[model samples]
Target chain A: MSSVAIDLAAVNKSYRGKVVVNGVTFTVAAGECFGLLGPNGAGKSTIVRMILGMVPPDAGKITVLGKQVPAHARLARAGVGVVPQFDNLENEFTVRENLLVFGRYFSMSAREIEAVIPSLLEFARLGSKADARVAELSGGMKRRLVLARALINDPQLLVMDEPTTGLDPHARHLIWERLRSLLARGKTILLTTHFMEEAERLCDRLCVLEEGRKIAEGEPHTLINEQIGCDVMEIYGGNPHESIELIRPYAQRIEQSGETIFCYAPDLDQVRKQLRGRAGLRLLERPANLEDVFLRLTGREIEI
Target chain B: MMRMTYGAAMPANARNWLAVWRRNYLAWRKVALASLLGNLADPMTNLLGLGFGLGLIVGRVNGTSYIDFLVGGMVATSAMTSASFETIYATFARMHTQRTWEAMLCTQLTLGDILLGEVAWAASKALLAGTGITIVAAGLGYAAWPSMLYALPAIALTGFVFASLAMVIVSLAPSYDYFVFYQTLVLTPMVFLCGAVFPITQLPAAFQLVAALLPLEHSIELIRPAMLGRPVGSVGTHIGALCIYAVVPFLLSVALLLRRLMR
Candidate 1:
């Protein structure tokens, strides 16, 4: 048996003469929580689709649970669960019926599906809404139900694509706690999100993609330290060029955006001291995190 | 270049297709009464209104009561309507609006599994509508009871023909509005020219030739004889044509949907 849950080697995909996922490579180990963090259209969803065998890569090899993709995709899918970015729940069925019907797609018997409905509902905190129609549930409730539906087969690997994209913080935290429990149960997870904090909280290791290429890969803190240093100071409400020139010597690197300047340094004391007496300059200092690392590596340019 | 293989595009397991069928069945079971009533209303209305209202004027063509002639044609039309509505509107809703096909694709179910299952479900719904109308016709003394039973398989075949052809339209459909072209251009024309409302002999010679090539015309030819207990004419040709409609479009639908969804 292979220790790798998913393996992609030199994978490439293009659509209509335009490259989407270009020569990407990564491996998700068994029982490890791996995340793909990138902005929209960074090919995160495309990569997820390829792994699910929904689309074939133009070049390279992909294996999930030791089975070659698009060849053994059905077999691989039988062992994998997916929570999509969109709400694709069966609108005609009740919450419980949704779970039951989806379970049938995996060839599970009625009794087998019924046996897990209670526990899965509890896992999603949807026990009270079990008989409610999907349309009757709130967005949070629907998302929870989708999560429960993904686990109907008790899959060995769970794939989530922007799982909490539209949820409120409370709902997001609820899902995050459930995901943590799944990781504790030793389930391998492959997650994709633009939410860096979500990745930092749940992923054992993560890779950042920009324009179909992986720009950085490591543990959250390690990538932050390597790419962004220990602290980030933002100075707004001052001449951007003047701020950059003053903070340049003390900082490891400086970036100037419209109306503000960001300075990355080992420590913020010197930069703060240099800018203290300057009037009309508003300064804020924070510990460096994944978002800083993401912005620095992928750049501040807005992807159209 | 690696040629795209149908082996990867189409599902190999029969059980997976059946599972898709079962999923639709379970969902439909909740609104079973409303669904049946909705499917039955149009055909029943046409049979009563046109059979009596229009029958008063064109009374007893071809040695049978006008109502009797209309009953068999209505059975064929009922199957066509039910199957077309299911595959075109209902299947399109699932594919685009509800995103049900995408959800099923995430499971072990292939796009081919969903397609075949949808075709089967549409056919089954058509069988239901056709069977109900046949029973009503028999109750009114227009059709032979036992002979009408033989029309069940023929109704199923009619359902398959329309359902498969409608799915080909669905594969190309971008939205619900796109279905209007098919409904008006294809379905409406077939309803009028396929001997469902009037005898094909009434049409011009050129139109008669065209009508003979339609699936519904073949359906009516087989069904009319079976319902009236008359010996079927050109049994080989009628059934053979209907089978071609069912099968050829089914393959085309699979190929079209593969291009649409698998890309």
Candidate 2:
């Protein structure tokens, strides 16, 4: 009954001499919803694989559910559930049969699995399609079924890797609501995603990773406020150096890239007054969010 | 912070492997009738075509009807074909196309559990195919009913050997087309050269030596004697060779698949 559900100490991994996860250390407490946010190739999936014992780390230690990883991964995994990034549902089986067969994988008897199938189908909003073949179900339905399948064993620790990556807004919201209910029931969740909004909505505490290194770790609001300030002002079509000099006196920080310059400040009015009526200059002001903090820390350059 | 300990570390066990087997069974049950018919058709056609067509001219080669001699070979080939198809095509579909193996890995099932379960399922399919042909052979009056009962374990062992060998091939295969190489280079050649259709004595001295080393030849050797109620020659050596075929490839398959799937 360790307070921490997952602990990674100085974990490192590489593929053919290219380091993917470098010197990463983090702990997820029991019943906490922790998020790992990063761009593609930032090693989010690699970390998830290491936790699942699918891959061994080249260096350092990992422990899940109080058991040392790899050595005790099976024991730990028995109490854990995972929803992988890809749709791995059995296309050959019907919706209910998919759950039924997956339940057996967790060692649940037919009687137990049958008993829960109805309720789990209802939970996934797929009660109407219980007998529908997986190929017949829509993409949203498939994702929901995958989510329901992960709960077959009522796992204590739920690991979801980019659970809402390819879904529509409607589907994403439904999944988020279901996840919230799971959290209320006191299940620890370790999630990874590229969507900053999803992390902000679901994660209790999150870490931002860039190129296999941790850039920032804290509560969402704290990271936003501490790193990027209260508000962000985007100024377009202004001379970069002049705008920087003009905004520098009033701004806490200024980030200039291409045609746009971002001004982070305690108050937007002071910076706004200086740029007011300036020829060909347009200003858009909004409250800072996790995306701002993410961009500021990880940079605006697209990671190839 | 309170710390808890797991009661025991569960290694790869029979229960987990059985679960994998059950999953495949449940899925296959949807098309069970069609699948059985598909499995039975090939062997029956061979029995009828070769038994009647070739038997007319050749008559008897070993003091028995050509149909009776070919029955034992048909049983061995059916087992090998069924097991090979299951492990290569069906298992590959689960691993690469359907991602069923990846799904199983997320649960309590280990890679070892998945591989063992796959082999067991393939062997079961082989048993079904071989047993069906054996029954048909009995109906055609080519096999003694009492002696045919003893062929069950031999057929099962044949299935396991071919299934394990197919698994080893699958672990290295890059695409579906890669299977053609195995089918051509290994399976087809063995089907003809392993005394499945004709006696090994009719071959050249070198080929006869080659046939003696093959698993299918060992399987047919054991099966032919048992089905005919004749005293099995060199029983120990044939059984020993079959055991080696079943076991060595199985271990190799496990090692290779573990490396491929477990990274």
DockQ of each: 0.68, 0.47
Superposed model 2: Cα runs more than 4 Å off = A236-248, A257-260, A274-282, A301-304, B1-11
Candidate 1 lDDT tens digits, B55-75: 999999677878888888999
Residue pairs with colliding backbones in model 1 are none
Candidate 1's error at B225, in angstroms?
1.5
Which residue pairs in model 2 clash with each other? A1-B3, A1-B4
TM-score of each: 0.96, 0.94
The C-alpha lDDT values of all candidates are: 0.89, 0.87
Model 2 Cα displacement at A216 (Å)?
1.5
| Weakest lDDT window of 10 consecutive positions for candidate 1 chain B | B1-10
User: If candidate 1 were superposed on the true structure by all CA atoms, what would the RMSD be?
Assistant: 1.7
Which candidate achieves the best TM-score against the true structure?
A: 1
DockQ of 1: 0.68
Q: Any idea what lDDT model 1 has?
A: 0.89
